[model samples]
Target: MIRFCSRTKLVANLIPPSISISLEQRHQSIATIAKMSDSKILIYLMRRDLRVADNPVLHSLIHNKDHGFTHLLPLYVFAAQQIEVSGFIPEDGGKSPYPEARSQIGSFWRCGPHRAKFLAQSVWDLKDGFEKIGSGLSIRVGMVDEVVKGLIESFEEPAGSKVSAVWMTSEEGVEEKREERSTKNICDKAGVDFKLWQDEKYFIDDRDLPFEDPKDLSDIYTTYRKSVEPLREAPRPALPKPEKNSLPPFPTDVPPQHSPFVIPTKYEEIEAALLKLINAQPLAKNPPKCPENALSVHPFTGGESHAQERLEHLITSGSITGYKSSRNGLMGTDFSTKLSAYLALGSITSRQIHASMSVFEDGSASDDRYKDLKGYGKGENEGTYAVRFELLWRDYMRLCTRKFGPQLFRLGGFKAEENAHLKWSRLDSPKDGFSKEQIQEIVERFLNGTTGMGFIDASQREIYHTGYTSNRARQNVASFLSKHLYIDWRVGAEWYECMLVDYDVSSNWGNWQYVAGVGNDPRGNDRIFNPVKQAFDYDPKAEYVLAWVDELRGVDELGQIFQAWTINDEERKEELGIADTDMVKNPLKRIDFKVNRGRGGGVGGGRGGGRGRPPYRPHSGDRWTGRRPSSQDQGRGGWYGGRGDRGYQTRGYQGRGYRGRGDRGREMRTGMMDKERDATADNE
Candidate 1:
């Protein structure tokens, strides 16, 4: 993390023009030294911190002009093999056939089509930015270590300049750490220096924290929050782009002039080179586009220019003024700040956003329109503080990665003393009375969004289509899978890694652990969400559910649609477009009573106190037909409230409705009590 200028200040000042040789002689001497030792070549190994402005590592080199570096090589390596992971290997020492199968599958790529598209866009954007400053980016597709070594060796030390140093921003995950160590080893062997600096992408520095040592920081978020909230440091100002003329002048001897910073590789032709790498795989019948456009209200474009434009809109459009109130919304473009996708890819930076917030706060406090709006409880600074508070959570996750290291990746996260008594399952093999066959069947259904739970199905479908979902939807789906379904949390985490465009290693894993009762939640309680209640509460009109769930959208009864699996053949065909003979005969799998009520007794004994009830086990062939109540028993109230034919109006859902529900809607109401009874029996 050392700055070049700070380290060499004395040496630079001592070599003033008054005491040195003539300017012409000095230039010749520097040129001779540069050719002799190849000391001017600095390789900037661009990783997560991809932007030019406010990028600490890049800024450090550009600022310390007297460090004798005249040429810079900006390099990015696309190492696809790094993402491969074994899906589920048993921990109890039993032999499994999965290891051999995984080996055969060569590419279990976690970065899916959507994220791949976003990544290509970002790399192209970065190359454009470099071109503006008389430089170009070198993109290679291979193992980072091997490619870097080849790049260093290709530099002929006698005739051309060799690499003097390699520079990159410090990273946090286990794989990133391994890459960093490999880079250091490569530099050591090549006799080149390796410099790593902490990237301020998460907005805070460890030096600003009150703790003497970062490891001493608590796993509990509240403790960490309380210690730093009032004492938070103001973010550093973002740096300006280097002047065009400041770049090394072009060589004039050649017929066509060229910038000194250009690299010798064929990557100089960026359009052709980048396109080859992006489309390395054979094209499908249909080509993939950016995922955000399909599922999100506001489509996110990848680039620093777009990032800056979005930030300005948030401030000037008064979106920042009301962020606190609208952040939890599930449907709209303005529901939450859509900056996360850009932040994950480092297209935009936290420092730049923080600086923008400061300006917005100062300006808006005096404006008449903003002054009249209700302050978010912390006086006039609530909106700004709220945004900062969220940023702190992002920082906490990153610091936790440093403090806990590889433990964050483990299934039993942090291994809190309170969780010692629990005996958890891997769900890949039989354990705790659940058979392997049943587990696999259920998990497959859940992943495919065919578990027959309306709310869960909709959320999963949205994520599959968009590569993005609201935080609320994420919590509900995660809770349902880990708590109610009782499957391996890692599978869900990995699935998210494969799907989410904004997936961050630290944030995604850390959040999964928190929801699964395996991470830093002080209560040691996993969050259990009741999908029915959540759907009713968040999407009161069932608009979100209707949008993603096609089956429910076609159903005629607004009130009875929640229990659509119970409908008789004749009514099902008339209400929905399906034929009477084609109606699914089996009952929907019963969503456990405890799950419907949102009871908590997740892996680590939750809010219900002691270890509570064992996991629920439904009867054999727990199909939708068997689970539904018979005609005689269906004369009671509906699942949530009321009986048949509840009048409905579409407020925000583009105005769609049902014409009829038939007599079967009343019959389905009688079974609500029976469902509650089944819940009691499961607890026993």
Candidate 2:
């Protein structure tokens, strides 16, 4: 299935008028294009790769040896069935921690609110990006293979024109691979060509892997990393946007609703429109913005421009140097490069990041102020090696999926037979002590961030609220779910698949299986993480715990606060010297931390300089202003239509800044806690 291709240069030929007339009845060709010269049309089937920059498929399309295409129709299919019916598994009755199943046209839909919102924003930004290059994306809502077939059937090649091939970037998931095969089958039946390029989402291109066969990739990450690090073959450089002449304008006359080609402006209108099209909802609004001072928060905005800016900021600000040490920080954007979401969506290519890193490493000046962490073996560049190191880890996960195929999605993963004895059978009776009801209750509490363990709750609350958390937080919470509660790892994996804004199939499931002791953990079935010790080690001052878990804000001995749920409110207020207040559910609230009047209490109790650390502002100016569509008007093709060059301005968090579900947090800060700071941090 490896397809390495260059553009075909064959001369365009006209299909007979007889065939053209028959095709016309099914698919109406663009009026303007129908009358134009006999140049053919090329459909760019946009999938994960949403950007115009560094797109190999688009590049090959335009550079076809014949230079044959005069029309490049960019399309995106909202695969409703794929999201609802394929990857998701509903709870057994009321036994799962996540939401109950909701049917959309007889099938269950699994995409959550936050991911839906982020995806909408990313697609909108993508449309804007394409328009700048003098083209429009014809967004369709349906299964990809069927949509492509319909488009091909309707295509009336001009009197002497032919349809060039349909092109798309390859995907790593088994389902995506199946869809690709299906798409090619449809194309074969229709007598049209289908082409694919290796998706360069990872730093090491699959075609350029050091191993001769994918099966040769190590089962362990370290072994794989050691084998590849020495080759030092820099990723292929990114290509710039194609010339405007090569991009023909999209048809503006496509019917609305079922096949509308424009980005919906508001969350509700878009939600409603998408629901009507496929009987599914995209209801989540943008998440709330973290305070400007919260350096550790991702402050994520979807799209390629934002991805580039974040990468630049990391390099120029010298944050890349300490990346190895700070990458695991449990909170905030500065702890690690917040590029995963961008990478996951294909907004930015891994080659672009690696290329940029190489240049930065070569040009960066050394500083004597910071000490290098021991054992932080980086790339040739002293401090940046860890960034590449992480990219290699991402590469290995993708390779793992490729090697193991669909089995990666199963409960036992690749080692099903080997781990058979460790699998626990389901138990339903409450009288048995380990009943499903009890386990479900525990899962519910974990999902709601009420597990009574401060470290675990804060991490869960972060993901439940923000659709994100640090890798450390994920591991800790996952350990609690699998090792402590002994729930099926698939449940947590599926929950994460629905919730995480940066969800990637291979990485998410692979990591979950690893922790659950069902996947490729050579360490065998002994994956245990102590929440208390983890809290003490990662958050000794309990600043992170207090930031997300408001109830523990006034507790003096932070160590004891992990189990604060065991204490009655009146007892806690008296013991911890805080006001008696209702439990806060939202993390965006403004909680007032009053100093203990007599004994002394307020954040670290004067042990770590009172308020602890000053707010960490990573960027000099605002980062969220440029990407939001100007109006929420429905049926308007001009929301981003007339912005001109300013459309791509690099200002205030480029693209629509993620504002968590747009529900304002309850304002709880008052009196002595008047000094309000941004709530922040996530490290993964």
lDDT of each: 0.55, 0.57
Cα lDDT tens digits, model 2, 1-684, are: 222122111111223235546554423333323444344567888888988888877677667656556667788776754343211212232222222233211122345656666776788788888888788887665568877877766654323345567878888776688778999998888787788877766677776777777788777666676667652464667787788756665644333423323345454555544334223432222222232232326557778788888887787667777776775578767777878888788898777887777655444325522223322233355446666766666677778888887766665666764433244312221121333344444444556666556787777667766778887678777766665544555556766766787887778878787766666666535445556545544675777777777656666665446545333456666765433322222111111222232434323323243433322212112111111122442232211001111011211111221122121111122110112110111113
lDDT of 1 by residue, 1-684 (tens): 423243243333334565558766755554554444433577788878778777766666666777667577788765534321121112353432222111111112356545655666677788788778777677665457766787777663343456777888888887788788998899899898898877777666655676877688887766777776562354556677665545433221111101111222332243333233324542211222232223565367667777788877776666776776666567877766777767877777776777777655555344454343333223336555656666767777777877877766565665532332232334433234544444544555555565566667666667666667777677667666665555556667766765677777778877777766677764334234555445544554556666766655666443223334545556655666633311133312443222222354422212222223334322222212222334543453221111111012111111122111121111111111121110000000
- What would the TM-score be for candidate 1 when compared with the true structure? 0.70
Per-candidate RMSD vs. true structure?
A: 15.6, 15.8
The segments of candidate 2 whose C-alpha lies over 4 angstroms from its true place after superposition are 1-39, 65-67, 82-109, 157-162, 248-268, 271-296, 364-382, 417-433, 565-570, 573-684
Report backbone clashes per prediction. Answer: 8, 29
Stretch of 10 with least lDDT, candidate 2:
638-647
